[model samples]
Target: MRPVDEHVAHAVSLMAPVDLDEVALAEAFGRVLARTVTARYDSPRFDNSAMDGYAVRAAEVTVGTRMRVAADIPAGSGEPPALHSGTCARIMTGAPVPHGADAVIPVEHTDAATAEVTFYQSAVTGAHIRRAGEDARAGDAVVAAGQLLGAWQLSAAASAGHATVAVRRRPVVAVLATGDELVDPGMEPGPGQIVDSNSTLLSMLVTAVGGVPVVLPRCPDRPGAVAAALAGVDADLIVTAGGASVGAYDPVKADLAGHGVEFFAVAMQPGKPQGLGTVNGIPIACLPGNPVSVAVTFHVVVGPMLRALLGAVEPKVLAAPAAEGWKCPAGRAQFVPAVVESDGSVRPATGGGSRSHLVASLAAGRVLAVVPAEVEQVYAGDTVGIMTSILENMG
Candidate 1:
């Protein structure tokens, strides 16, 4: 049997980062930047007012000093006339400060008169002013390459004068669920049958990791079904659940065995049956049948692959104290769907710990509590490594 880390590394090796493409800033959210974004112009663009007040020369202003409001300067107004002595500009926030104006007294600190404003407080030079390039300078790197574009990153990119950015294209993932005993969700399952929840689970997981999920038609256990459904399909990766085990009815193992897909007994509980290879030039990953196994394998193997394709770094594993104790599978690594509490302690999401078929527990799980193969038990308050979901860490 292969070690868990070996399988994860092998699976990720099958994927390559997608090509870089220029996309509009509006459509670049959640995408990874392929190139470093530099500032086109100085941040703040120009010397502007940080507050709605009168722009004045500090040396000329004192308590009770009345100055003539020479001009009104609202935002976007171009180049007001230079301020002469004993004169001030009524400047709104974000308005460019007039030349020779070194200070701004907020409106609250003066009489609310526009034409002839009276200041009750003294002015300080450079107060309430946003100097050009204060935040960043032109040609400075604003957003580094490989950074995921989010609201804040996008805002910075736009503020740096970028209308479009070069980012890695999102990967298109094809998801297929196999099992003769499975039916589509919402339909009542007959005796000895179950709903095909793995499809929905895999699809949602794929999307959460920044991949476009194309849910393929469900495949049965019959010969050639898995291969036929995958024929002529176009995708960056193919993920299939079920039929990779050593069962007589495992079609995924049967059909794709000699065609480059290698099945392995990974040293991990609930997700030991793993298959990874290419089918028709598209990388395919076959996970175990159970829903919990699907979730675990997605985090351990598939999520990293999708992240790699997007030029995204894998999420850092956090170490937190276990809120309770649990047993682990001997000689096989365990990934228990668990929740990290607000107090930074971790606990199982369900009472049935590490059960592969506990589908409902997945909804409550925020992270996967990873245990080494040699560790047989986790006592209360013992520190454990956790792999958080990508959705939880997205900004």
Candidate 2:
């Protein structure tokens, strides 16, 4: 059996990075940036007022001083005339301060007037003024490469004068769930048959990792059904659930064995049966049949592959103390569907342990508590490594 880390590294090596495309900022949300974005101009662009007030010379303004409002400067107006010795400019928030003016007294600090304004408070130098390049200067790196373009990042890119950003194209993933005993969801199952929820699960997982999932039709456990279902399909990666084990009716192994897919028994509990290879230039990953196994394998293997295609960094694993004890598989690493409590401790999401077939209990899991193969059991207060979904914690 192959080690889990070796299998994951091998699986990720099979995928190539997706091509980059220049997309409009409106459509760049959730996309990974392909290049570093630089500022075309300074942030705030010029010296502007941070508040709606009068732009004045600091040394000229005093308490109870009455100055004539020589000009009204609203936001978006062009350069205004310079401030005279005994006069000030009525400047609104975000409006550029007039030339020769070094301070701004907020409107609330003075009597609200249009033609003639009286200052009840003295003005301080450099007060309430947003200086040019204060946040960022021209040509400065605003957003670095490989950063996911969220609302905040996109806004910064826009403020850097970018109408469109170069981003990695989302990888197209074809999800195939193969099993003779499977039926479409929402249909009543007959004897010896079950609902096919793996397709939905895998598709959602692919999408959550920033990949576009193309859910293929269910392939049966027939001689050439797996090959026939994936023939001429257009996708960067192919993910197949079920039929990866050593069962007699495992069609994914039976059909794609000689055609580029190499099956393996990974050293991990709840997700040991795995396959990693490519089919006709497209990468393919065949996972175990159980729902929990699919969840675990996708997170450890397939999800990382998708992220790699998008030029994204891998998910982070945080170490936390175990809230309770749990037995682990003898020689296989354990990936228990677990939850992080409010106290920052980790525990199994269900009492049933890491049983692969425990589908219903998988929903309660928010993270995977990873244990090494040598660790026979996790005692309470023992430090354990927990892995979270990349998209779940992305902001």
Candidate 3:
């Protein structure tokens, strides 16, 4: 059996970043930047007021010193006339400061009149003025290539005058859930059949990890249907859930074994049976069937592959203290669904161990507590590595 690290390495090795495309800021979320983003102009664009106040000469405004309001400048208005000696301009938040104004005294500190104003105290030089390029100067790098785009990144990019960005195209991943014992969710299954949850879990996981998930219909245990499904799907990556085991009805293994697929054993709890293959140069990753196993393996294995395929920077692994004790499996590494406490300690979502199937009971977890192969048990306050159950939560 291959080690979990080896499997993870192999999964990453099979994938490559998709082609880059220029996407509008409206559609940049969850995408990786293909090129470094530089500021086109200064962040503030020009010296502006940070608050609704009077823009005045610093030395002119003192306790009981009054000045005539030379002009009113609100945000987005054209440039106002220069400030004359002993005079100030009435300014609103984000309004450009008039030339010769060295400070902005907020309206709250004034007499609250529009035509004339008196400061409670002396105006500090450069106070409440947002200087141009204070946040970023022209040509300053705002974001690096391979960085993932989120709300903050998009906002910064827009502020940098980028209407569109060159980002790695979202990898299209086709999901084929293989089994005869599984039926569509919301449909009553016949005897000996259960509802299919892998499709739902995988598709959402794929989207969470920044991929375009295309979930196909469930494939039956028959060889012909499995082959046809494998041959017909078009995507950047192909993922088959189930049928990697040595069961009698495991058609994914029985039919695709020698047909460009390499079914193998991975030394990990709940996700031991795995397969790696390619079709027309597109990478394929086969995961185990049980809902919990499917989720765990995706977090531990497939999620990284998808991120690599999307050209995302490497994921950051975090370590936390184990909140409680549990029996760790022998010979195979174990990954249990867990909730990381606010203090950075983690505990299992359920008392029941990492059984290959128990997704229903483990739904509230946000992380997967990992135990190494040689460890036989865990004690309270032990340090353990963890994989975020929500793939996007990593880094």
TM-score of each: 0.90, 0.88, 0.91
Residue-by-residue lDDT tens digits, candidate 2, 169-242: 99999999988899989999999999998998998888777789999999989989999999999999999999
Give the number of the best model, judged by lDDT: 1
Weakest 10 consecutive residues, lDDT, candidate 3? 386-395
Q: Which TM-score value belongs to model 1?
A: 0.90
RMSD of 1: 2.5
Error of 3 at 331 (Å): 4.2
The window of 10 residues in a row where model 1 has the poorest summed lDDT is 386-395
Local distance difference test, each candidate: 0.91, 0.91, 0.87
Say which candidate scores most in TM-score.
3
Ranking by lDDT: 1, 2, 3
lDDT of 3 by residue, 1-395 (tens): 88999999988999877899999999888788999999999998999999998999998888888888879999999787899998898999999999999999999888877888888878999999999999999999998888888888889999999999999888889998988899888999899999998999999888888788998878999977777886767798988899999998898888778777898889899899999878656788889999889988888888889878777777666789999999987888999888878888998888887888777545778878889999999999999888766654524
> Any idea what lDDT model 3 has?
0.87
Error of 3 at 236 (Å): 1.3
